[model samples]
Target: MSGDHILETQDLTREFKGFVAVNKVNLRVRRGTIHALIGPNGAGKTTCFNLLTKFLQPTSGRIFFEGQDITREAPAQVARRGVIRSFQISAVFPHLTVLENVRVALQRKYLGPSFQFWRSERTLNVLNERAMELLHAVDLQRYADLPAVELSYGRKRSLEIATTLAMEPRLMLLDEPTQGLGIEDVDRIRQLIKKVAADRTVLMVEHNMSVVSSIADTITVLQRGAVLAEGPYAQVSANPAVVEAYMGSANVELQGAH
Candidate 1:
């Protein structure tokens, strides 16, 4: 692995009993770059993500973060090291107010307060200010006072991204960020992601070709748990193997349209 790589996998593999969910896979994400992973459903993309984030341990090979071996690191430890994941599904607390959810996330960095205690008015006020800053960054300040469950689907996802930013991550893992978003919401989220990624590295699993092409600095096409191709948007899109694996015969027609 190169010294400058922020994240890398060497022959990473995961198995459940006799079945291999993720086969030998190697990946290298450059520092401060947006690297996208694209693949079809059941192509082992999620499995590879789980293994990298330490949600599941790899059956073989190693994972390195910041040039250090972190293959067996606990998920919390990995996250604390500035690598955080924003789940595909909303992970916010629906019962909590939007501001409260963000404050909870911010307060987690300081272990002095018990999770059960309602923060003092002064402390809450400070946390609320910071939460609003993050909310505003994600274009979610207007919904900050509402109950999280009452927010629209797109807003809920925005809240998730805001909460993740409360941790001030150096590297972010995003899973299907634009899924289920309307065109407007998709555009907003895409811009929000780019804003957050200005100084941090973002590794995302995205299926939308338009989204990938718009945001990805480099693309890795995965198939059957391994990388099929890796390059810039135009290069990967033109690769015959990648086209067959994901875009299918229609890719030729799509390319013609472009």
Candidate 2:
């Protein structure tokens, strides 16, 4: 519950029926810092995110956000508390114009109980302006008027980030933001994430080591549903267990040497 930490988990565990997916996890995310969670497939990275965002409730653990316990909060409730998540797949509304899609997301942030379409034109325009600012922040302003369905794959991902920014989250949970991106696109997204995390906390599940090393202030290596090592990039990558887990013994010392 320290002010410097935006998120803290106390023995966070998630189970499916009788099987434990995310074992007792104690994660700490510093305020305004970018933290990367990396591991091989089935390492419980995504499940941890689900527990934080309330997409899945932990079987027996507590999640604290900004010093408040929110373990049993619902997904929408967690989001309203300023903890938002962006999925791996693009979640933009394909039929809507790019600008319109962003505007809709912004509206959702402020609408609360009202129906936006039924509101005044001025109100909608105000929301549109805010959305445009978010779009430009993510470098999708040029495609504002284009139908989202027609945007390139990378552009669509940018739009998704823009939409999430419209929510004005204090902490963002990014699940493989660069999963299918090419090298160039991946670099762009990495830079965007760095920019976004400058004044906010970001906890991302990224498999790309280069991307993680470039942007992450700290990296947590997870294995078999538990944290194997957590520290700065150099420290965690140098851990014998982490090196062995990723590339066997061959690539271990070599990567650490760098």
Candidate 3:
């Protein structure tokens, strides 16, 4: 693995029974960049993500992170090495206040294993300033005192990002940060993603081509469990095989990126 690449997969494959969901994928994500993994449904994007996070072991090949082979590491082990997946892995609890939610993740990072409910309030308060800072980074500082369940879907996503931020990841895997939101919220999350990627590497599996094109430093297109194209938006979007795989109106969405 090169120093510039924060994450690398060497011919990674995953098989479910006789079906090959992710087949021989070779991905190299550069440090401090936003890389987008996109494909039509059942293209194995999610499977690839699961493999990267060690949520699913690869049937063949290897995964390397920061020059070390991490193929056999457990999910928690990989996470400790600074790969944090938001939304799923760093979920925000609905009952906890936004600040408290972030504090829980901080507790995991600063105080070890999560949900240390018996810890002194003074010890937990030690994390509040940092939690507020993370909340501010995601533009959710004003919602710190509010219950997470009352937040709008977009705000909830922001809170999730804030919690993920508390873990201080070197590589953040965002799964559809803008999946369900109005145009205004979509724009807000898009800008937030760019801002967050400023100091760390981001690898995301996103459906919105416009979002991918707008912020992704590199885009990888997957089809039928394999990589079809990988490059900047302009290059991959113009590839004929990529266009054909997208098939109908999705081609328009791809071109719309231009």
Candidate 4:
């Protein structure tokens, strides 16, 4: 294991009813790098993310984070170790204001498992300052008082990112961060991701090649649950196998780097 890597998987494999969802795959994410996992429809990207986040236990293999073996750790335990995952669906509370949602996340981190519901208003008020800072980070300060459900699709995703940031994770695992958004929203989220990755490590599963090329420091191309190629955008984009994997996709061009 290299000292520079924040996360690594050794022959990570997962199976469902005799069907292999994630094959024997070894993955490494360097510290403070934005790494992307891209592939065709059934490439096991989600499964791989699940395995890393401990949402789904692997059938075999091991996971390591910050030089510690986390393969057998629970999801919450992994999260406490600074590995957090954001889902494809926005995880924000529908009725809670954006500021309140981020405050709740901060509460979880600071208050711990024995959090009391009857805590005084002053206690919650102390978290407001930090929560607003998080909202500002994701450009959600303007909508801080609005209910999460009232935001546009892209704004909801931004709020989700803000809440995740409140956890102060060392490695963030994002599953399809830009899925289902307009071009303008996609661009906004892309910029937000780049900004966040400046201070932490991010491993995301993204299909949009343009966004991947624009923000990813390293790209891992998967095919049928196994890695086909891994390198910088310039190298992986020109790989013959990667090009053939996305042969018919009009939007994904494996010849250019953004």
Worst 10 residues of 2 by lDDT: 249-258
- List candidate 4 stretches off by more than 4 Å: 114-120, 250-257
Model 1: how far is 46 from its true place, Å? Answer: 0.6
**lDDT tens string, model 4, 48-99?**
9999988899999999998999999999899999998899987888997888
Stretches of candidate 2 above 4 Å error?
114-123, 248-258
Weakest ten-residue segment in model 4 by summed lDDT: 249-258
Which tens-of-lDDT digit does each residue in 29-145 have in candidate 3? 999999999988889988899999999999999999999999999999999999999753335788989999989889986787867878898989989999989998998888889
lDDT of 2 at 167: 87
lDDT of 3 at 29: 99
Per-residue error (Å), model 3, residue 70: 0.6
Worst 10 residues of 3 by lDDT: 249-258
lDDT of each: 0.84, 0.85, 0.89, 0.91
TM-score, every prediction: 0.93, 0.92, 0.96, 0.95
**lDDT by residue (tens digit), candidate 2, 1-258:** 788899999999988888888999999999989999988777899889888998888889899998999998898889989998999888988998999888778777677754465667676777777877888898988888899999988888889888888888999889999988898998889989998988788999987788888789988878888889999998888788887787643212326232
Residue-level lDDT tens digits of model 1 in 133-154: 9888988888877999998888
